[model samples]
Target: MSEHDFHVHGPHDHELEHAAQHEPKGFAGQLAVITAILATVGAFFSYMGGATQANAALLKNEAAIRKTEASNQWNYYQSKGNKQNMAELAAELVSSEEQRTKYRDKVARYDKEKADIKLKAEALEAASAQADEESAHQMHLHHRWAQATTALQVAIALAAIALLTRRRWMEWGTLAMGGVGVVLGGMAWLQL
Candidate 1:
């Protein structure tokens, strides 16, 4: 082969040497990366579950409010005392009663809907919790995951700091811990 071609393929070539000379991230670096990923996942699911619960609660409250308003309207119509007004008011009361009944029915429907939503939210929450637990367990398996997966993501930045400082051990440890935090955060965000 030509000298130029030989140089290109040689192990001592600049590109090859540069790539080979790169510092090893080692076990710690791998652990940190894995932990961070897991934590992020956990956070996402938790947020989703919480948001579902909140929406269900809001719907339930709205149903109650509507029912209350309907009752108030019915009572107001019944309270007027003039005979002519009373007669008209009585009719209005009946109409209001119908509306109240409708509202009550709506409330009942909402109640059922809310119950279903609540159940779904609860199930999601349980899943989120289980994910968190698993992430935490992973962190325990490797300290790096636990430290990097904080709920606040402060740990992730901290992991970067450790990396920058050439503190491979700390970096990995932080990353391992962060997996659960990430998962929980992700869950919350999804719910929102």
Candidate 2:
């Protein structure tokens, strides 16, 4: 048979399909339903964690870019200041009034340019700071999502264990963990 004509299953796939078809009753059925729900919740949490992590990374990159821009503006401001100082010194040394006035005009122009550059640099710095704050918040949310996902995974594992061991305590443990996972997920959603 051609490769396209064949089908393959992972180690647990056959058993999973069988379980789906059989649909266990009573306690096992309840455990199965809870496990399915937990799995779904875990998937959502995992997705949110990844999305938040990506947002954090993107915001951090934006912050870095803004910081670089601010640094460049500061450098420009410094250069303008240096030019103004040179013009001031030239104005003092020039004997002719016309030459002195020209140098003074240059000094004034440089001063104005420096002021504009400083303002731009300060604004960029503020923008960078804001981006950094946003990135940190996203990272915090990502961590919360990760925690929720972990708890749900643990709950799913407990459900499997309870199903195999037929232990009442394990079932309770699974429910407790599931509740914790859901609560964490809610907290993450609320950004608390």
Winner by TM-score: 2
Report the lDDT tens digits of candidate 2 across residue range 5-119.
9778987999977766764446788898999999998999999999999999999999999999999999999888898999999999999999999999999999899889999
Q: What is the TM-score of each candidate against the true structure?
A: 0.36, 0.87
Question: Roughly what TM-score does model 1 have, to 2 decimal places?
Answer: 0.36
Provide backbone clash counts, one per model. 44, 0
Runs in model 2 with CA error above 4 Å? 1-25
Give per-residue CA lDDT, model 1, range 94-189, as digits (tens).
657776565555545544554554555455445545554544433333332222234436655656666556566766566555645555544444
Candidates' C-alpha lDDT:
0.50, 0.94
Per-residue lDDT value at 124 in model 1: 49
Give lDDT for model 1.
Answer: 0.50
Backbone collision tally, model 2? 0
Tell me the deviation in Å of residue 79 in model 2.
0.5
For model 2, the local distance difference test gives 0.94
